[model samples]
Target: MNSHYSVAVIGGGQAGLSMSRLLRQRGVDHVVFERDRVGHEWRTRRWDSFCLVTPNWQCNLPGYAYQGDDPDGFMVGADVVDFLEKYAASFDPPLLEGVEVTRLRRTRAGVFALDTSAGRTTADQVVIATGPYHAPAVPRIAERLPAELVQVHSSQYRNSGQLPPGAVLVVGTGQSGCQIAEDLHLDGRQVHLAVGSAPRAARRYRGRDTLAWLDEMGHYARGIDEFGDADEVRLRANHYMTGRDGGRDIDLRAFARDGMRLYGHLRAISATRLDFAGDLAQSLDNADAVAEGIKDAIDRYIDSAGIVAPAEARYVPVWRPDSSPSVLDLAASGISAVVWATGFHRDHRWIEVPIFDGRGYPTHERGVTGCPGLYFLGLPWQWTWGSGRFAGVAQDAAYLSSRILDARRQRFTDEVSWLAGTPTETYPQVEWWAAA
Candidate 1:
């Protein structure tokens, strides 16, 4: 083994592999550490019917693009895994599979020492591309639920086939939750979706891809640093409603068309029962209000941005359900399952770095971390829309690789003066972005 390389990538997924490929193109030596085989996470994702939300064309990884017949079409999970494996094989990304990184500590000499199950290794630079969706974020109220009621995180859910034959309660209004609800409804299961804030829906305006248009207009390219804090928050919040693909819109109308019931967020979960805040009429009204707000926001953004377009553009509401029902009351309606698609949380207890923020994400700029040579990629909204997604990781990897190369070049010039030393403090120093 090289013992030390210019860079050490701590993941083997699209992010890490892409970074490796970019580094290779730049003639930088690097090794990839993967807990299992390459693309293991994608291969093991909970949904059997899951397909890339971003089309195959967007799923490019470094030098190679998706060469299959369906460039614009979504690739199934297995196909995606296969593509990644092939990409790695073609590029010969230096990967150490089945090697779990147990500890990543910063040596007193400023280099990162990775302790893996196989052996220990050190590198001048480390890229933590372990990704954002580490663990599911189930609500605390779930523990109160009676064991008799089946509970499964969306990550563990494959399809309606795994669910019990009863009314299904989905506790989230995010993309995963909404999609799962739709799937269940299509499978002839009674689905009750517990929604929190309404998400921004992808509006197919005049048959154009909404996301493509946004990209062309440089929407995702602008980070929170470029836009003010308020705009960034609004953009982040709006993403919940808007589908990643601009063209294939997921609207309340679609959910309603599929006969899925939408309800207010679940307040409590008892044995085989759930409690919601608002009454049925009130819940419906709330959902409508949220949808209207999202629609208004989209219109405002388009108008302010001077996006001249026809008024006949289709607007998808964030939430749509004619009526709502209590979780307990749904039993009488024959609802029998609960799928929690409430998103994920990062678990960095094993990371052994003080670099994490309150949310457990490593504090880094681009890919540079507080500890010198320690980097991170594949983080949610790290840079832009494509930061953590499989399709977006290439851009992130390229940018990150450039930064690392620059840092590596400067390392010999001035240890303390270069890059102002390892950042002891986080950036955007505002209370919102700052670590709590």
Candidate 2:
């Protein structure tokens, strides 16, 4: 292998693979560093009957599309891995598998240095394509649950068959939690779903994908700079539903209709027991209230902006029980399993770059950071509606590659001066809270 490349990509998932392919096509010398086997995270996903929320038509990498007969059809988890492998193979991406990047720092000569298990390497540019879903964010309250309750993060969950045979309490209302609850309910596990703010559910309107419509209508595609402040974009984006389509269309509603009890956000877990904020009816009411707020926001946006958005994008109503149940009541229900599908957090302690914000996320514009030659791709909502999706990665990759090429052509000298006493490179140091 070459001692260094013009660019080094620090992931090998769909994003990294796609980015590497684009760079290769541009005749840019680049190498990919993958900590595990190719598509390792997808292989370990807890979903059993999991399918891409996005249609297969949108599953294309930079230069490859889903070659199967069903383009509009959703792909199963295994099929996704296979598709990614094929994509990587087609591009002949220079991938170093099982090479974990332990540290990333800037050298004195204005090059990025990467320390990996394989060895140290230097590159003119670095692309951090490590995805948003790399780390699972489990709440601290999980420790309070009894040891026998079989508490697990959604990442560890596979299918209902892998779960303990009893009533299950799913502690999130996100896509993963809803799908798992539905699956467990169908498998005959008395399932109870703890609803946080009910998520905006995806629904098809007319004959188009909701996301496509959103993108065309400038819902998510609008830039943060286009809006006055980041807060507005964040709020509007939060109102947008995740990729989950519908009740019958997706699995969450099916689980509810099939008799999965719904609860509010988990308050506490007592000895083999769980406590909810309110009764199911009250929880459902709370969910309804949240949905109403989202609807109002969407309506206001349409009314003020005069944008023709999807009409059938309605929020699914939570299953409202005729009789409300009591809080702190689980023993009588026989709930034996609790799945935490809360979400994920980014941990960049191993990255020695000072460009990261206090939240540990890299502070970057599109892909370029304050530090020259340091770039990021595949961040959630990095560019537009398609930013983080498999299909969307190629566009960002092409754009970033062009930017890098432009920078190289400009021959711009490094304007940011290094501190006099500061070391040229630094080792990975754990953040204070992370160490605790």
Candidate 3:
């Protein structure tokens, strides 16, 4: 194995693969390290019925965009794995699988020292593309629940059959939670969903796919600085919806109409009971408002473009009782399972650097970190709203690769100057293009 490389990409997913492809194009020497097979999360973390929320057209890598017949259709988890595998195999990147990057730190001489499961290696540049979601983020209150009750995260859940027999309480209203609740409910399990402030979204709006419209409007490409509260926008909950069910709406209101019991946020868990916040109705209203705002934006776009389009019908609001208790006795309700879908936090514990902000997210100008020779990719709002998605990482990767190329050029210039007895100060210093 090569102990040294110009760049070391710390992942094997779309982000890392795309970065590697761009680096290779620039004639940059690099190696990709993965703890498991390529696209490990798609192979393991996702549920059995998992599918990409974005359509096939949005799944773009560096050299390979989705060329399948179903451009509008969503790819299932296994199909995604196949796509990634083919992408990696096609280029045959210098990928070292089953090699976990246990630790990464910058040496005194400014090179990255990576301690991996395979062996130690050094790189002049390092790109952390491990993605946003790392560990399951169940609340600490869950530990107070009874041991008999099966507690599974969305990552651990496969099918309804895997869960013990009884009613299930899914403690989230994000995309994953909504989809999982629908799956379990449709499978004949009594489902109770804990609604939160997750926004609702219409899968299609104004005679076009919502995602397509957003792309057309440059919504996805909006930089973080464009927002008033950048952190708030970055940390905003994903809208409640699903690409399954033929792109039908799957918000909290939809779930309630489907006979699924809805509750507020999971506040606490006692020995045999669960306490919820009394804000279900308010939460649903907030989600509906967001949905309306999105549709309004689409309508404005149609008008601004002078495109003739049919008016879309508005969704009817679902009603709930004004007075509902804020508590549930889990034992009395016969709830045997709790599926926590509270989302995930990026685990950068292995990194010993000061490039992180107060929230532990990497502080970067695009993918280039404040620390020279270190970078991050596939992070939420890393550059724009789409920074973390399949459609966006390629752009960020290309930008980062260009920066690396500039650095490589400078390195060569310095080496030649040193060998010729020329003063290093006489060498021309060229600045790389800054991300816009």
Q: Each candidate's lDDT (Cα)?
A: 0.70, 0.71, 0.85
TM-score of 2: 0.82
Using lDDT as the yardstick, the better of models 1 and 3 is 3
Worst 10 residues of 2 by lDDT: 427-436
Who is ahead in TM-score, 2 or 3?
3
lDDT of 2 at 116: 90
Residue 365 lDDT in model 2?
84
Write down the TM-score of every candidate: 0.83, 0.82, 0.94
lDDT of 3 at 299: 90
Please give the lDDT score at residue 408 for candidate 2.
61
Candidate topping TM-score: 3
Best by lDDT: 3
Identify the runs in model 2 with alpha carbons over 4 angstroms from their true place. 218-220, 227-257, 279-326, 412-436
